[model samples]
Target: MDDPKNARRSDSLDLAYNAALTKLDVATCEAMAVSQAIDVENSELHLGFSVQIFKKLCSHSVALICAVPRSRWVKSEFENWDFACAAGQSRAIIEGFLLFLYLSQTPSCNAEWTAKLLVLYVNDCTRRAKMMANVKAVDAAEDWMRQAEELKDRLKLNPWFLNLDGKTQKRCLAGDHLMISSRDEILELAGWEKAEFYAIWDLLSQYAHVLPMSFTRMEPDGRGSGAANEADADYLTATIAWCADTLHAATNRMTAGFPSTETVRQGLDSKFEPGPKENRP
Candidate 1:
């Protein structure tokens, strides 16, 4: 015998998904309007290594706007939170990529440095992935080690790359060792200071993870962080508020020339303009 309850549940889920898709379409159109304003073909545009980050930066920005659900019925005791959680994760990544676009303005984002950093990042990530796949993933580990050696050799091209630590810069990255010590150096080369990075982008990272302190902010009553049948209105408003702030920051930082960025951002913000709080069943 087929259960009608299951069918109703499926239908409700489909409705919720479709509502998010509708809102996602609005966000997408807004993002597209902004992207078209750029002239990537102009010879004066110094978007060599930066272009790569540009595409990813846009993707992250788009993902951020798409994760907010638009429909009122998305009210679930807990299910509605899935997208919010994902949005936070995407937010963290977006913050990092925005930093890259900012840095691409400097010599650090040049082909030489980009190549070395890419190798180190990719190889180190793969080695870690393989380590998880197989405990004795020695080959992956060795490959990363070799690339780290090559990257160290290239660092000499930019002698002042490690100006922060001076002569005692104990900087050689080895097996399973990432070139993290040079991160501040790269930021400095991009005319950005470490204090600003820590204050702005780095601190929000805690929200990206399922940390113990995060749980402290949640409540099962649906009135708290989890989900509320009616209180969800508050959460949705808050999410859109976040999207607007980040979008503006990203627009200012990356300069993607999104013509409709301001308009769409304003429109999105309009969705959450202060109104009577709806918290009824």
Candidate 2:
């Protein structure tokens, strides 16, 4: 039987989740529009070394926007948990983009950074492929690993791959040395405050991992169903809104000089300069 408290909690959660989805939609649109400025007809966007990174930012943003699940997706008890995990992942992507852009200093992007990014991407692909044990996909991951090395060599990076430790996780080639940065590392790189970042990531991970902390917050009916309370609504709303703000930053860096983003002004500016395409790897 459904308790009044449970019903009230479910209603609140549904409303909050729907509202958050709308905000995510707006953020995605704004970010895409900014990218369009760079991709304008005949304008000839010259992403050069940062092309892959830009593409990743756009794709991840789209993924997050597409992840706004509805009632049908919440049939199971763990449905909300799944959605919450997606939110955390989306948040992490935005953070990575921000830190990478800051580090690239891309007004004059170069091959070294591009090669490094490719290496990181390959490593991530390899890690995921190995984790899942899909034979065909594993072969594809090997190809990506090979391509990553080629990029490193093309960039004249000596001692490209390194395996200091035997453990796959610890193994790193020369390019791997600079590939992906952890969340803490990105925080240091971006020089942004961590209050919001830690709060959002930690709170979301509770649901994503099915921690006892998360369970304590759920209003469970006698049946297997459950609903989160007001705090979930408040925190999720804030988290998604912040994600939109980060997306705006991405668009700003990606299309800094384009006419489309002319009106999109903010205090934070990177030394953004379009680089020549001659050194693309």
Model 2: per-residue Cα lDDT over 114-231, one tens digit each: 4445556555645554544565666666666666566545444423323213343243344334443445666766666778667767766676676666665454541112233455
Q: What digit string (tens of lDDT, one per residue) describes model 1 on residues 119-177?
A: 34544655665664477667776665566556555654544544435433343333343
Clashes of each: 3, 6
Q: Give lDDT for model 2.
A: 0.52
Candidate number with greatest lDDT: 2
Stretches of candidate 2 off by over 4 Å are 1-25, 40-89, 99-104, 107-111, 121-125, 128-185, 209-211, 221-228, 260-281
Error of 2 at 269 (Å): 25
If scored against the real structure, what TM-score would every candidate get? 0.53, 0.57
Task: Report the lDDT of model 2 for residue 52.
Answer: 48
In terms of TM-score, how similar is model 2 to the real structure?
Answer: 0.57
